[model samples]
Target: MAEFDVVVLGGGPAGVHAALAAASAGLNVALFDENASAGGQVYRAPLEGMRAASNADQQAGDVLRRELTASTVTTFFAHSVWAVTGDYRIDATGPNGPVHCTARALIVASGTTERVVPFEGWTTPGVIGLAAATILLKSQGVLPGRSTLVAGCGPLLAAVAAKTLEGGGKVEAIADLAGTADWARTLPAMLARPGLLRQGVDWWRTINRARTPRYGRHTIIRVEPADERLRATLAPCDAAGRPISGQRTTVLADCIAVGHGLTPATEITRLLRAKHRYSRAAGGWIAVADQDGRTSRPLLYVAGDGAGIAGAAAAATHGALAGLACALDLGAANPVRLTRGIGPARSAHRHAARFGHAMANLIALRPGHVESITPETIVCRCEDVTRAEIEAACDAGARDINQLKAWTRCGMGPCQGRTCGDVAGELLMRRMGTASRETVGSFSARTPLRPVTVEALTGNFTYDEIPIPKAAPL
Candidate 1:
């Protein structure tokens, strides 16, 4: 029943900045976040009862929180927004109960999801994603494990390795998909944002000083629980990430954190039916938007990794730009202020994005990676669906993800295709001999977008008032 001029989805750097900019322009704004605090993964706030540390990233987040507190923006922290309607009816399960809001314009800065390719033990108990390990280390002050093997691509490999070392964990080794030469190429792009680049360099140096055996151009081909620990097979990878038949070494570690960069969470954009294009190497399906973040839909905007896989710096600037652009479009901004802010924000955005975009491009899923999935390897963890099932679905004439889900139950999990959709679609595309993911279109996002309890949704509505959905036609 509440209404506002703008409602921002996400509490990351992008959402925070967008709300700040929009509120500064004299528009009513409300920000919703899944966290108890404003910071997202990168600048995640430590859990309550943990001592707050003073660092550059933490300092930046502190400044943002202070600004948010002082602003007129209504904040909805720890809200699980399950559904956003076409008419901008926002439904969320808040701390107390059901909450609803509407807005004239909406900005989705919902950030990214870790991209995972199926392997032998991806679904095993202790094998976690970089995102999980990040929360363990950054937010909870807990070591991922006594001995952890960090396996993945992009900047997070170095960052997590460094953080694990800082948290007093033994880094068994780092199995990185990209070689040193690849990072050398990415270095020039990162140089544009010296502050962020310096942080990356520090991470690299920490792991290097620790003498962690960084297996360059290598991948964790297999993993299995050994005793109370885990044993992983690290194999050299070809340029396309296919396992080379040469030497492969086994490392025993208590924990394994693995992921291949991030995929922009495009569920909102796709659900809104905005113009989108497929670029697997860049990102999967990104909403088509101008430089200022205005999407094909006039009332909708995308910022941060939701639009594309940019880092926090780019996300913040891009958010500022989106908020200001939205203000200008809505005739809410002061002409003088908009003119002053837009140019600097745009330039800074481009500068920071170069580094982030390069990192994102480096982690692009190679052709051989998905092809190497063993038949028994589970692709969808939620449903225990295997690669063999996906292939069988393809054999039985499943043309797209939706059809594949229907045939093999691949994307019909609690995550709602967030984790396995990309890998599943990639497998289907290879079978169909198509390079474009658009060929085997993405899963249609079902509403009540995430899992919600019946009690939370039903509220005081009577049985007759409770809407029942029609069954799908056979």
Candidate 2:
């Protein structure tokens, strides 16, 4: 068991900044990350030697790595927090056994979970997520497929298509859900961060150079596996983002990479019972917090994409501000040490968030996309609950996710509803229009955030040998 002045949950840009700031303020800080190294998805550390790919991300990640290494913060890599008990006690599984930590303040920068809309053949082998494709290209030094058809909303469509081209993979087509008009609307705000905008423009140029057909306001209707290849059917979407039934085109590719932006990974926020509200543009129900990421829960802050759908730059500043907030609120440091730090970080965040918000709006989930789900489409892959079954539950008066789980067993699988919860809730929300989204709340999260075997849970005493946690000080 260990205790600290602050404990940060995640090693992404936000969490790293938070821990560094808090420790810099003369506070004992502990940071935990699920990956073997620090850096979450956006600034994820590339394989040593390979360096995987390039961009501002590479430079930013390097600087972050150097600073974190120089900081006094105690770092725990490959540590997954399974639960938060009491005010700010962390229960996690580390290298050997259970890691117990109590802190005066806790910063949750768990980041975002990639949101993928369900389709007829989403479960097919060759179909991957736009986010996952980047992981393959950036960290694994491998391509998604020989010929990948990239489909989705937001800037990732162009970025992934371009990266695939860079990795020597053929890009058959780029299917974007946002039309030209929609992108035009975001231009003003996206221009707030000219560097990122320039990066995006470069990606588009690369895509065009490869002669990849780009379809605007288009979405993947479905993908059918044909021998060793995939036949992806796409159609132009209406104003609401629903596919126009009759205008379908098929693109042949060995793989399909599709995604619908990202949602705040709210398992920790929900477990801690922070206030939540629905903001479609911010990627569904998010934990409500101040600019410094202070939540309803006392001394608990949420930063980065976990608070909302802000990009990596905004997340970093937001996290540092949260750390400074902890120092101020918890009396962990002198006011003089933090006064200068807070204002500059806040201004930087506001500037970066302008571009981030524009991107969020671009990838916002549209009602028509969720409504377009066919009756046969599986809503919960873990439990195989079809859209029809979920709708039937809604028709039978199941409003909240808990009620749906009770009646239809939609969230009863091993996942306990992480992947399917938001999409399932969106289905339920449509049934109760004008009603508060909070009324149709998400699935209640319990301990052990991720699935664990019984042996791991019970210290493996009953089945095999394993280490056990030493009793804490009485």
Candidate 3:
């Protein structure tokens, strides 16, 4: 029964800004996030041994952390949001037990998930997504291997390469489809905004200084294992699908970091019955919201990567606007000034949309990416389901994500379906000719979002109301 003026779910950039903006307006606020600490994927924490190796410019979360702590918002770390009820009732697991809390307005800042591409030998020991490698470096300060090949398209590959070099790991080369010509075309878009352009220039300088070979117009045709390590064969393909042997090369590395791009985290928003649309520029299906981050549901709002795969900066801008809009909806302050926050937020969204569109198109993977999937490759690591089982289920008419999960148990594991749900859904969609819009389903959520000990749930420590004390300066 804990209550507050606003409850922002997620501790990343969007949630951080949304909470601060609302608290600055003198409204009681509570921010809940699953991670023990703040900082989402982009501003991941430096692991024990990797602190000194992290990229400085990309670490914007460091600056925002201080601001959130000083604000009037109370933070609930390691808290999972199980479900959102009418009028923003949130059920969470605390040290005590399963507790239900309420908020006058709710803002969702849940972020993005990696778009995992399945291929031969992907389930090997050292293979991981580009983002997962970065996470390991940020969270545990460990690299998957001494030498790694970064294959996939997007700015994240470059970012990961920069991190690998910083962490004393060797990046053999970056293989991407976007060649010099395509990158040159995107240059004007980058240069149009000085701030963005500078960020790009600084990143390019790091790539140049590292002396890591970058292969534009290159793709990984196949990956093989040798002596328990990975050997990737990459080649430049012509328009007619012929390999350019002169440009073809083989790389022997300890690991391969690969991913197409990121998809929006839209499960929570969908749970709230928000309208969504397929936005090619935004990566995939995203919640349809207004200029101020107002979703179809009046009491609900979404910002950051949850709304779409816009980066952290855009997430922050949308967060500010959503916070202001939520306050106005709840009758907290002057609506006029709050409405003004939309102008800059809208402009930033446009800029982000353009960049996201270009990147999505450039790195778009072929539908046959999953063709190499075999019966032995694990599809759901938590549940131990195999790719063959999923294919069998699809052949049996389990075309939708829900049906596939029920029939093959692909997403029934302890992690629910958060990590592997979309991948399964996409695979089914590709095979059965089912469209993505209808395949999206609500995540199978249970009560007490966070896992609490049995002793705590039975105790008298359930927090029914959020304790909002005297206001603090934001």
- Against the unseen true structure, what C-alpha lDDT does each candidate score? 0.88, 0.87, 0.74
RMSD of 2: 3.4
Q: Model 2: clashing residue pairs?
A: none
Per-residue error for 345 in candidate 3, Å, reads 3.4
- Return whichever of 1 and 2 wins on TM-score: 1
User: Clash totals for all models, in order?
Assistant: 0, 0, 4
Model 1 Cα RMSD, 1 decimal: 4.2
* TM-score on alpha carbons, each prediction: 0.95, 0.95, 0.84
Model 3 worst lDDT window (10 residues): 442-451
Model 1 steric clash pairs? none
lDDT of 2 by residue, 1-474 (tens): 789999999999999999998998899999998887788998888777775455788788888988999999999888778778766888778677777889988899999878888989998889998889988887787889999999989988887898899989999998899999999998898778789889999998898888889899898878898888999889889868898857688999998999988988888888889888888889887898998999998998998989899899999999999999998988865788698878899999999889899999888878899888889999898889999998888888887889999998887887778678878988888876745567788888887787765555456354346557899999
Q: 265-331, model 3: which lDDT tens digit per residue?
A: 7767776778877654576667889877899987789988788776676787778878888888888
lDDT of 3 at 107: 94
Q: Model 3 Cα RMSD, Å?
A: 7.1
